[model samples]
Target: MCGKGVNGFMKRIYMDHAATTPTDNEVVKAMEPYFTQKYGNPNSIHSFGQEARDAVEEARKKVAHLIGANPSEIIFTGGGTESDNFAIKGIAWANQKKGNHIITSKIEHHAVLHSCQFLEKHGFRVTYLPVDKYGLIDPDNVKKAITDQTILVTIMHANNEIGAIEPIKEIGKVVKEAGIYFHTDSVQTVGHIPIDVNDLGVDMLSMSGHKLYGPNGVGVLYLRKGTRIDSLIGGGSQEKNRRAGTENVAGIVGMGKAAELAEKRLVQGEEDKLIKLRDRLIKEITEKVDHVLLNGHPKKRLPGNVNLCFEFIEGESMLLNLDMEGVAASSGSACTSGSLEPSHVLLAIGLPPEIAHGSLRLTLGKDNTEEEVECVIDILPKIIEKLRALSPFKGSWEGLKK
Candidate 1:
């Protein structure tokens, strides 16, 4: 890891919070006892087991409190993808007799998208709604897409790649009115933004621990009481039989601690700091560079998110250049970063494939400083300039290359 040109300072600047955040020290300390001192199966009935069970239930309560959910409604899962799978497939399987139809947007995380696709192959019907230029799913469009057979409406709360916050509350009203169950894959928004399951009117929602500075391999599916859903992993009687697997005690404890910390941060208005940094990053980059498009809604985006697409150069080239400067960033969702294809979310939002290929995503976190952002703002323009100079896609702007 390094930063900037020869004379420039070299320091590792991590700006990829959407991918994952460093686990908070408090969260790690909370989990340490569970891993060593209190190791026991939560399903056991003995004292050790009861202690573990108590810890798990307490953690469940914390997670529920974070999102205004009842403790009994939280079903622990392996991660966000599994939580999403449980929400989509579990609901689809359980409610197959009610209807065979599902509604979701095209720009959803692959976890939701692929789950819906799998349902389609199994004699189910899915309506893949389109998004506008800002990656927003119109509530009116959702209303129009409903049918008598529509059983579920699964939309994302926020887009990971573009940081576009969907009209989830509005869509929730539409789904509730139609008597269809609603689910939101809120992996990108859960800990980063203020959320209330009741206010959102969602029957089910998905979130991952790692996305909120907790340990990986643990997540939650917040299923509103009485929402008919089947277990995705059926073996043990864990997660109130809604999900079956041995609980990850340490991870769950970490998640609970992380959730507590996140809630405190939100209540303290700490996210406003992220908003300032995010806005500064966006404002400086667009002002300093030319042929750049800021992706997602200008204001209705994640407080820590800044996604942009620079024209005339490949995103990979810019990423590599930035890496040499010791600034860690990404072009899109970390899940699909290895793929050679342009982001589907970018295309869904009306960006051409060439333009989409140049996208960059920078998500801020509590540890990030204004100075670090300033460093990125300083070196990024230089990287983009050098890349553009060597870019073969340069057209009328070729005369500026030197």
Candidate 2:
């Protein structure tokens, strides 16, 4: 992780694991043969194709195993966004006869949000449920949102921006009792946490490979058996006629290997280790800085997520300063980067526009170390102090008042 910084060459600390991870060496090796030696279309009928087909099925099983789903129920897609679209639109269209109503939350990823918006234009009704100050969607809200014409309810297992873990299982129970289909965008939680589709009581779930140190071009949709969903793509009978496309052999193999490694790491207590780092970052930032607020549920959030809103200083300025010092992070959801507007997730969680503009998300990974955490803790305060001094609103800073 060494890099050329503003001062000199230094260690580059990555704190944007939620955006994507550095693909594991093992995953790269597993995918190497497929790009050349085992190059074959899984849809082909020849021996080369059969070999690829076998690898694809094996990868599907690995992905399913990670989430306690059946291999037969797994549907390979281009990425998380595609899986989300397939789930939301597929169910809405396929079961339109049953109802035209759908339910989701205000703090969902763009993939889910855009999908629901698209459905709303095409005669489908969608209810965007609100979250609490901590960004947790109330299960009772989901229960109350159901109508006679409700068809599906889509929510995320964990928020990508704030890392607030939602009550999917409880919401799942509510949807099930109403006989409405339920789907979850588990892209942020899938590889990082233990998940069981049956336990969550979800009819469908979406995940991306890159979030788990796998290849970037692959993802999966766990479509439980007997779920009514229409196919989005229609060219070949691939993916069991659910998602039609030739499988991404190399990427799929990489994702499968990554899934196995993620499962092993989770069972070996890697999550607890991340929690310690996350807490240290939060604790030090709060104690050493003024007018800063933690952005998510302190205990119910992800093990590796630390979102902080530092008043008076802008997030982009802080990110630029951190990058110059060889520390990498994000102001908000990576997908929404480059936008001048404040983060929608922060706003949804009740932060004012000025405070939301100051939010920063630091997501940890297995590769991060305590030394790195300590370095960040030391460097960040200096960066904040420098930025705050330059800020026009510095006179109003809580530290100045204190």
Candidate 3:
């Protein structure tokens, strides 16, 4: 809740929860013992090892409970990227005899897209489905894309850039009927929204700890009990030989506590509050800012995600100004922000490169408040106006108007 920026900015407001979240105090408290006094590899045979193993299994159960899966189905990994790589590659390699074709969307995270590309180079066929203007893939497209050679369908439950929620359950039913494995990168939606694997009909799903206010370097890939998937890493019998290397005991413990807290908040209607705040922010921004286009489905998007395009000014300029003004946001996904090219997600949805470059993503977290929204509303317009006044495009348009 502290908003102090590095350059002595008095009021720092973080609106980049989609990139990562601060670890919760309760989660930190739950992980304290494992880091020091009780530290031991879960594979060891000593008493300390037994204690660590017990804690890890208990954490597994907690994560499983959040998603309506069994503890044995959850295989811990490094993080969401690793989980995505494992799910996409694991299924492709395991079911190679059945088929070599994989179906995924163009708007997938690099983790999924790059894995599919890797498979493509290894003699696998990948079908990259396109999305609508609202950033949603049609279930009919998914059905039509399924060929006899298709072995896997890997799509994201919610997009990280635009926050568009995919119809995973409908797509899952199609994949289920086709007898192909289904995997979804639920890194954004898992903790923020209610998820039930059976309800979504996904055989595999990926989740990250940092996305849910847990420690980093910990994630889970939920593989249904009977799903056929190979290990991405070799060696060790950890995770029932499904994943290798010793477990991150403390990080796992923190993830469990974070999951439990998120579930509790859901039951208490905290998500509803977030929705209100998000909607209010959007409404005010649109009403006040001219030439600003809202990206993604207005109603169906993630409760805390507000992606907008402020035309005539580059997104990097807006971001830099926002940072100096003590507002933390992103021009795009953290992984792709460094690229000079416009965001692929925006381009996939048919945005011009210039407009795409002018995009900004403000994602709220549980700790964000209405006061923060007001502060942003007060500060952002001035920044945009100043940037627009200095823009050559704005000057040209004004000259033409005159």
lDDT of 1 by residue, 21-93 (tens): 9999999999999988899999898988989999999999999999999999988889999999999999999
Q: Pairs clashing in candidate 3?
A: 3-12
> Any runs in candidate 3 off by more than 4 Å, and if so which?
1-9, 333-336, 395-402
How big is the positional error of residue 252 in model 3, measured in Å on the Cα after superposition?
Answer: 0.8
lDDT of 2 by residue, 1-402 (tens): 334445655769999999999999999999999999999998889999999999999999999999999999999898999999999999999999999999999999999999999999999999999999999999999999999999999999999989999999999999999999999999999878889999999999999999999999888999999999999888888988997777899999998999999999999989999999999999998999988899989998998999998988788888998999889999863233766667778889888777787888999999999988988898899999999888878647444432
Using lDDT as the measure, which candidate wins? 3
Q: Residues 205-310, candidate 3, lDDT per residue (tens digit)?
A: 9999999999999999999999998999989999999999989999999988999998998888887888998998889988998999899999889989999988
Q: What's the candidate order when arranged by decreasing lDDT? A: 3, 2, 1
Name the better of 1 and 3 by lDDT. Answer: 3
Error at 330, model 3, angstroms:
0.3
lDDT of model 3 at position 126? 98
Question: Candidate 2 or 3, higher lDDT?
Answer: 3
Error of 3 at 129 (Å): 0.4
Count the clashes in each prediction.
Answer: 3, 0, 1
List the candidates' TM-scores in order.
Answer: 0.95, 0.96, 0.96
Which residue segments of model 2 deviate by more than 4 Å? 1-8, 333-336, 395-402
